[model samples]
Structure formats: structure tokens, C-alpha cells
Target: MMESAFTRPVARPLVVFDGDCAFCTASIDRIRDRIRPDVDFAPWQRLDLTALGLTEEQVENAVQWIGSDGGRASGARAGAMLLRRAARPWRLLGTVMLIPPFSWLAAVVYCLIAHNRHRLPGGTLACAFPGPNRV
Candidate 1:
């Protein structure tokens, strides 16, 4: 049986993403396939950023994570945390991503993609909404 969102014994990390960004959505989907089933997926657009203790500007900048203890992590740090929550090989990859040079590179890559995602194949204005119109 699937676990209840509130009843899962372990504290599930929450991934706050851009619901309108096709690339971000697809990336989250891929990450979901690799991570623990308990992790939560929430769109920043649909959620109250303040409730998550995040500012609107921060959400627009990058994905964020709300830990069980209410600690926050953003950008590559958040990505690495999510990957580590996944199992095995992915965990190894997350570890590598945490390294100095690799982490720095990952952050830059994330920023570039985030800034230019609208021009990518799956990215378009329609992706901002949920419907068949999305690319």
C-alpha cells in the first residue's frame, strides 16, 4: 500500500519545484523514479512559500528542500540531498556531487539550465500551466 503523506514515520524531504517549468518538472519526475517513495513533491507556484519558510525570490532562484527538522537547503545542495535519499548508485553520485569542484560545476550547470530552460525543447510558456497545451 502507498504511505499516507502525513503518516510516514520517517521525515520525508520536501522538494519545492517550479510547476510551470517543463524541464524542472521532467527532472523532478526522473528524480522521483530514483528516490525513496516517501519524499514529497510540491510546486512552488502552488504552495505558500512563506509557509515553507522560503521567500518567493528564493523559490524563483532554485529548488529548495524542507528537512524534517525544518532546515532548508537550496540549489545543488538540495539536489545532492535528494540524490542521497535515493539508494545505492545514486547515493554515490550524490556524494560525488557534493565534492568541491563537482558541486561548484553542478551549481553553475543548474543555474544555466534554469535561466535558459524556456528555450529548451520541452520548455515553453505553455508548460507554466497544467494541460495538453504543455510542450
Candidate 2:
């Protein structure tokens, strides 16, 4: 039987992201202004990865969601959680996204974007894979 590891309880959901990536920072900025959730944003560089039960590889690959209940989700799931935090139609979209086939598709789309994020708006070669290790 497999045992779980993440157990730290958060008072609110926290988002762990790659701070070194311009694209990531810009995306977060847009989300913050638009969604304005009570969620906490912590760049992996400034956070304690061990305390969060995270690794360099995980943060490097995708954004992560750490819920108040200690539930953890990554990539598209993480994005979905943030969308749910948004207002109205975006929240509704988030709800629909988490369902079955849509969830599967969301994951695929997330991976594609994440992998090529360096090529996205505001991104640079600095956002490339095996990106800056400031932590």
C-alpha cells in the first residue's frame, strides 16, 4: 500500500510557482488583478520546499495548489482551483473543467502550455527548462 506524505495544514490555499520565470510572474499578476482571491502566492525560491512537500522538479514542471485541507493538486488541477476562486463565469468554467473528460483535456492543455511557457508572452530564454536555480 502507498502512503501519503503531504499533511501540513494551510489556513488558506497556497499557490507555489516558479518566480524566475517572467511568463509565470506575468501570469500570476494578471490572475491576481482579475481573480483577487484570498489565496497566498509563494514563489518556490522564497519558500521552504521541504515544508511544502515539494521538489525542484515538481515546481519546475508545473504550478501547484496546496489547499487548506492539506489536499494537493498540480498543473491543470492547480489552475482549475484558482479559476474556481475567480468570479462568476470563470468560476463556473472552473467547475465544468474539473469534470471527467474535460479534466483530462485540461491537463493535456496545461502540460503543453507549461512546457512551452518560455515561448509565451513576456517569456524569455531565462524561462527555459532547467531554468534558473535561485532557490
Candidate 3:
């Protein structure tokens, strides 16, 4: 039987991402170690995607954030959401990232980074897999 989202106890919001991608894992680790944001980070591999209203295809694409209240954000917005849960400077940046020009730039930057993540530091061949970008 699959566990539903309601059955899960979330002390904070959740950040879901592709586990198969080394870059993704490394990035999450950095966030955990450095940012220490008040959010739970999980690889899509270990969780029942359906329970989170997510799919392999969806998570395979870009980062996702699900709030304790079930609010969601994807891609750069997801990054913003995560930052908002973090400490001062980062939180402030996240807020600014949500504004018009900044949000637009973030989206573009995220797309470029996503497309070339395999070549980025900490990335691997696994990060190069072709997939749709839902964010």
C-alpha cells in the first residue's frame, strides 16, 4: 500500500529532486551543510512520488518544493522557496529572487544550468540524461 501525503508528518517543507544525479545530491548536501535551511530534503528515489503528487518524470526534470501546507514551487521558484526557509541573507535573496526581473533572470539561469548540469562541478554522466524540464 502506498502512504499518502497526509499520513506523513512534515516538521518543515520538503525539497524533492532527482537522486540519480550526483550533482543534485551534492547540491542538496551543500544546502544541508551550509544553508541549514528549515526544510526536509529528499531524493525522489526513496519516496512514493504519488504521495507527494509528484512523478518520476516530474522530479527528473527540476527541483521541487512542497510546503507543509502543500504549497508547491518548481525550478528557480523552488530554490527561492528553499532560501526563504533559510537564514537571513539567503532568505533575503530568496525574497528578491521572486520579484519580476530577478525571477525572470533566475528562470533563465536555472534553465541554462539545468541543461548543462552534467558538465558542472559535482555532476556526472547521469546528470546528462535527456528529460523534460517542468520548471
- Per-residue lDDT for 90-120 in model 3, tens only? 9999999999999999999988988788999
lDDT of 2 by residue, 39-109 (tens): 87877887778877899889888899988878889999998897887788889888888998999999999
| Candidate 3: C-alpha lDDT | 0.86
Q: Considering every candidate listed, which one attains the maximal TM-score?
A: 3
> All candidates' TM-scores?
0.78, 0.86, 0.89
lDDT of 1 by residue, 1-135 (tens): 223233443257787888778878888887777565346888887775655568866876788987776777888888887787778887888888889999999899877777777777788874433334533
Q: Tell me the TM-score of model 1.
A: 0.78
Candidates in order have lDDT scores of: 0.74, 0.83, 0.86
Candidate 2, 35: how far from true, in Å?
1.7
Candidate 1 CA-lDDT value: 0.74
TM-score of 3: 0.89
Q: Candidate 2 at 135: error in angstroms?
A: 13
Off by over 4 Å in 2: 1-9, 131-135
